[model samples]
Target: MATLLLTGASGLVGSRLLPRLVEAGHTVRALVRGDVTLPAGAAAVHGDLADPGSLRPAVKDVEAVVHLAALFRTTDEDAVWRANLDGTRNLLSAVQAYAPRARFVMTSTGNVYDADATRPARESDPCSPTQAYPASKVAAEALVRESGLTWSVLRLPFVYGEGDGHLASMPGLVSRFGLHPAHTYSVAHHRDVAQVVKMALAGTLDSRVVNVTDDAPITVLEMTALAGSEVEGSAEPLTDPWHGRMDGTLLRELGFSPEVPTVQAAARAGIL
Candidate 1:
């Protein structure tokens, strides 16, 4: 098993990924900005992606890196840019200095794809993100691409699972953002996300950009229902039909079939 280093150990996906890595018999070193309780069989290293000097200790001697850290919910665009873009550059620099040979797996978002796409966004799609979060992620992706390290960027769709608050907050977000009830989002489970991370580390996936999602896209109305809420009004005409729709064909072809294939299935599995 490989000795791996991971960032965002305290995050939702990272918290779940740690246990899976340990169960796979890998020696896991998790990086956090402060003290954090690590999953069993994993060691925690104090480090911050924004602080390049602190990242050295975390990257040393590790065989691979799965970077999951980012600021997602902040309204402050500058803070988001620094954490996502600058932090990624800092981490890549450390990787180049200490673990250049390590497979660097970056967890990106599907929102980085062009929001005005006429069809489901693919890996080859051009990016022109309007939001700060996805904009920062797109910038971060560029850094990873030019870093000269063995790398893979996983563009994940909206991920949900047990204890995930995203779905629960869907109602408020829909109204707040003026999203139509018909607005669709490609969704995935946390389990599937962890599975892909394992595959990325195993080198089963080729180094490049890959989109990860469940079998199909779900409407906002459907998602709201899953969250135990109702969409009160008819959907307005959408300007960007492909805002959240993503093609998961590539990930499925790569032998990653989700156990929870849809939002309906997720609800049945008690993950909604």
Candidate 2:
């Protein structure tokens, strides 16, 4: 087992992933800004990504870094940039200076893909995100790629399950984004997110940007219904059917088979 430094331990994704990393027999040091409770096996190391001075101590001697910290779903665009791009620059600099050999695994979003793609977005597709969140992620991804560290980037889709309430928010998001009911989206369960992170730490996904998603791309109509809500059905022609869909062939080629293969499967298993 390796000594790992995990950022964003109190957030939705990190909160779920931290205990899993510890349960897998790894030593985990969770980096946080203020007083916060962590999973039993993790040691808390107070630090903020915005403060470069606080990062060195947290990263020192770590064998790997799982960077799950990012800002999204906020109206403040500047805050989004600072937290996502500038903060990642700080972490990358600290790791390079303090723990030069640590493997860096950064989680990103599938929204970075362009909306008018002909098919499910691939790793090589050009990222042209117009919104602040995904734009910042694209810039941050550039930093990680150019940081000269052993790095792996996981582009996550609509993460759900484990009562995170992310799936339940689909109805609101559908109305907000003006999405057609027939439009499909790729998704990942929290369990599968941890599974892929373990694989990255094992060096199975070095020097690659991988799309981590489940086996099925679910429709917005089904997602809304599953969320215990309803949306108006649309028979109108969909303009961007593949907008949020991603190609998971790369992950499969890398020997990844999602534990929760589909949202329907998740519902059946009582995990959603």
Candidate 3:
């Protein structure tokens, strides 16, 4: 079993990914900010993503690194940039210095490509990140692409299922805040994301940037309906919700298909 170095193991994706990695016969070395109790058979190393020099202890002697750490979002801009960009830099430099040959599997977001009107964004389309999170991720993706180490970038969309709590409240906000009517964005489930990560590390997926999404796409109204709520008004589809979707063909070729491909099934699985 290769010793897998996993960052953000306590996070939403990483938390779920650890057990699967262990079950697949890979030893997991999880880096955490504090003394985080890990899943059975996982090793914990105390470390910070924004601190590169302090990462030697965490990155050493690992066969591959699955980087999943990042600040999600906030009202503060400066802090957000530093957290996202600096953390990425620190992790890359530390891995380069400590384990250059380690396969770097980065979990990036589809937001790297600006929110689009076109349904089903492909891997070949251009990127224009309007938001800070995606912008920094784009920079990080570029860094990984240039580093020359064996790496794969999975541009994840709005991941759902696996007990995602936020989905319950989004539709309730449509009338509360009067959000501009926009088509619902594409969504990937938590399990599929973890499955593709393992695939990337196992070298089954060849694309550097795989658009990790489910096969079908849904609009905001459809998503709300699936979630058992109403948006209360007409959500003019500013862009083709389908264009924001990924073909999911690449992943399907490798046997990556979510049981719940649409919002209705996802919500039902979540018991909403």
Candidate 4:
């Protein structure tokens, strides 16, 4: 098993993925900026992504680095850029200097795709993100692609499940953005996120940017209903039907089959 360094182990996705990696028999060193509880079996290493001097020991002697740390859903654009873009640059530099041959798996977002997509977003599509969060991610992805490290970038969709409150926030997002009720969104369970990370660590997705999503793209109406909330239905003409949706064909071609293949499946399994 690989000795892995995991960033953002206290965050929504990392907190869930950390235990899975440990249970899979990998030695996990969780990098934290402050006092935070980590899952059992992970060694906590004090470090800050914003401080380059603090990252060397965290990246030293690790076989892989799982970068799940990123800033999103905040109104502070400068903070978003610093944490997402500059932070990623710092981490990449540390990895190159300390663990030059380590497998680097960075999690990006599907929000990097253009709003007026003609179809589900693909890895090959040109990212034209206008928002601060996705724009930072797009820039971060560029750094990863050119960093000369053994890397894989997973552009994730709407991540939910395991009581992360992501689905619960859907109603407010719909209300705030005026999203259409029938607008579909690609989603993945936290379990599948772990599965994809394992695959990346195993070298199934090296030197590529793959979209990690489930079998179905669910609509806002269904998502809000799953969250025990409701949004008014609309029959208005949808301008960007494919917005927030992604094509998962590349990962499928690489033999990826999500354990929780749909949101409905997750609901039925009582994991949602």
What C-alpha lDDT do the candidate models reach, one value each? 0.87, 0.95, 0.75, 0.94
Q: Encode model 4's per-residue lDDT on 1-272: one tens digit a residue.
A: 99999998988899889999999999999999788887778999999999999999999989999999999888999999999999999999999999999999999999999989999999999998889999999999999999999999999999999999999999999989889999999999999999999999999999989999999999999999999998888889987899999999999999999999999999999999
lDDT by residue (tens digit), candidate 2, 1-272 = 99999998888899999999999999999998888888788999989999999998899999999999999888999999999999999999999999999999999999999999999999999998999999999999999999999999999999999999988998999888787999999999999999999999999999999999999999999999999997989899999778999999999999999999999999999999
- Candidate 4: worst-modelled 10 consecutive residues by lDDT: 32-41
Residue 173 CA displacement from its true place in model 1, Å: 0.9
lDDT at 69, model 1: 92
Clashes of each: 0, 0, 12, 0
Query: RMSD in angstroms, candidate 2?
Result: 0.9
Candidate 2: segments with Cα more than 4 A from true spot: none
Give the winner by TM-score: 2 or 3: 2
Q: If both were scored by TM-score, which would come out higher, candidate 1 or candidate 2?
A: 2
- TM-scores, all candidates, are 0.95, 0.98, 0.88, 0.98
Local error of candidate 3 at residue 134 (angstroms): 0.8
Query: Candidate 4 at residue 34, lDDT?
Result: 81
Report clash pairs, candidate 1: none
**Cα deviation of 174, candidate 3, in Å:** 3.8
- Model 3, C-alpha of 10: deviation from truth (Å): 2.0
Ranking by TM-score: 4, 2, 1, 3
Q: State how far residue 38 of model 2 sits from its true place (Å).
A: 1.1
